[model samples]
Target: MAKRRKKRKFILRRVIVVACLLVVGFFFAIKVLDLFGEGNSKSEESVKEESVTKEGFIEKIAPYAQELGQAYGVKPSIILSQAILESDFGQSKLAKKYKNLFGVKAYGNAPKVSLDTKEFVDEKWITIKGEFRVYATWNESMDDHTKLFVEGVDWNPELYKEVFTSKDYKEAAKAVQDAGYATDPDYAEKLIHVIEQYHLDKYDS
Candidate 1:
């Protein structure tokens, strides 16, 4: 009789252990399912957002290439390419935040904007209160970028006058790079890459 009693107690303990394990496993399974559901929902929302606005951003900036080609005698291809490289096709943190498509720094009475990091210049990085052109929209940023080449002090007037006399975008882009408008070693190459990749030259002619 005592042996039978002992056996019954052992069975009860095993049953209790199994019940506890099942409860823990059910909670874990629910938590995992919730995590997966949340992940899928967030991914779907991201895809929807991207689909809605990606093309619009591309369209809005497209006109600037032609304008730059006409005004600066720089190939629309080069202008478009350079903008893409500098701003990562308008997806860069700086471009998104400041609307500075050309990565231009304000020289004179322009309004100043604070930057989290210093910009490289004269072979050194310096921290200073710098001015950047702020715009109401991406289109405004692209418009200003074109105007800068046409009317800004950054480019040498004499070089532009001589090189762009033909009003050819290709020649003008090369001249601007040769004249040291930017210190980047691969600036010209990058512009060419962008132009070829996107066939941006179509906008010029």
Candidate 2:
């Protein structure tokens, strides 16, 4: 009778252990589902926020700046300030004509859209289709510009790493110029000027 009692107790303990494990597993699954739901909600909110329009051109590019900053670890303000200067807030002739916001050129028979051409090798200026990054809208252009800096393997990250580390736009621009990203001696000065002129750094934070 004592042996039978012991066997019954052992069976009860095993059943309790199995029940505890099942309960723990159920709670863990619930927690995981809650986390996944929150993530989806946040992603949807981001997409909706990106589609909204704000008062100025600077506001319009804020989302792009953030995406670029996240991608390259560079301050978005610097990129936005440079874009404003380069494309005049998307009103430049090149932007309107060829969608070339960064002044990138086509080489070696790549497909291009012909804009007015200039002579390069002592030959007459021929109507040349300039190869440019194409986008469906200005927002896409801004997004692409950020991606170019962050993902472009052709450009060295070391050149902008110091600049990106600085939170101040002036420091960042100066670092960029000092690192030889552009040939112009006044590149930093010009970038700073544009940032201040348009209050572009407000988006960085």
Candidate 3:
């Protein structure tokens, strides 16, 4: 009877150990599946968002970008990227209300609208009502953008001179930042990201 009792206890312990192992394995498998499922879900969400947003913006501007790029001897990709960034895929209030794709501000009381714009100043973003140029059409906006690079800002030819001469899209991006195209320190990086993400470089050709 003692031997039998001891054998029963041993078997019970073995069964308990096996049950715990099975439980652990089951939970681990569940956790792994959860992780993979979440990852895939997030990836699918990102792809969906990209597809929706990419369809409307550049497609409308590429013809103008290509033509102006050729006329001004600049990379079409850079021009398109600038428009995409400044205009928020041509959906920003400034772009919508004024058809301003490049965020070119108006001076000397030109036809313009005072829009609430954020500018990076003193290492922080400050809100200011800036005067932005209004365009009759998007093509006019693109034309004015090209003229800005060719004719320069404030009638000063020094600005964007390197950009006008750059042979590569990347170089033109750097030159744009160097010429103070935007107050954001990461302006070039953002442009490059837009350029690469949308394959805007194809227009550069």
Candidate 1 vs 3: which has more lDDT: 3
Q: Indicate which candidate wins on lDDT.
A: 3
- Collision pairs in model 3: none
Candidate 2 per-residue lDDT over residues 24-52, each given as its tens digit: 99999999999999999999998776444
Greater TM-score among 1 and 2 belongs to 1
Model 1, backbone clash pairs (residues 3+ apart or across chains), number: 2
TM-score of each: 0.64, 0.54, 0.74
Stretches off by above 4 angstroms in model 1 are: 26-30, 33-55, 67-73, 88-98, 112-129, 135-140, 151-155, 160-176, 196-205
Clashing pairs in 2: none
For residue 147, give model 3's deviation from the true position in Å.
Answer: 0.3
Where model 3 places Cα greater than 4 Å from the true spot, the runs are: 1-50
C-alpha lDDT score of every prediction, in listed order: 0.68, 0.68, 0.88
- Candidate 2's C-alpha runs over 4 A off are 1-55, 106-131, 155-157
Error of 1 at 182 (Å): 2.3
Model 1 clashing residue pairs (backbone):
74-169, 75-169
Which candidate model has the greater lDDT, 2 or 3?
Answer: 3
Per-residue C-alpha lDDT of model 3 across residues 1-205, encoded as one tens digit per residue: 9999999999999999999999999999999999999999999999998777766678877988898877778789998998889988888988888899899999886799988999999999999999999998889998888888888866687797898788788888999998988899999999999999889999877
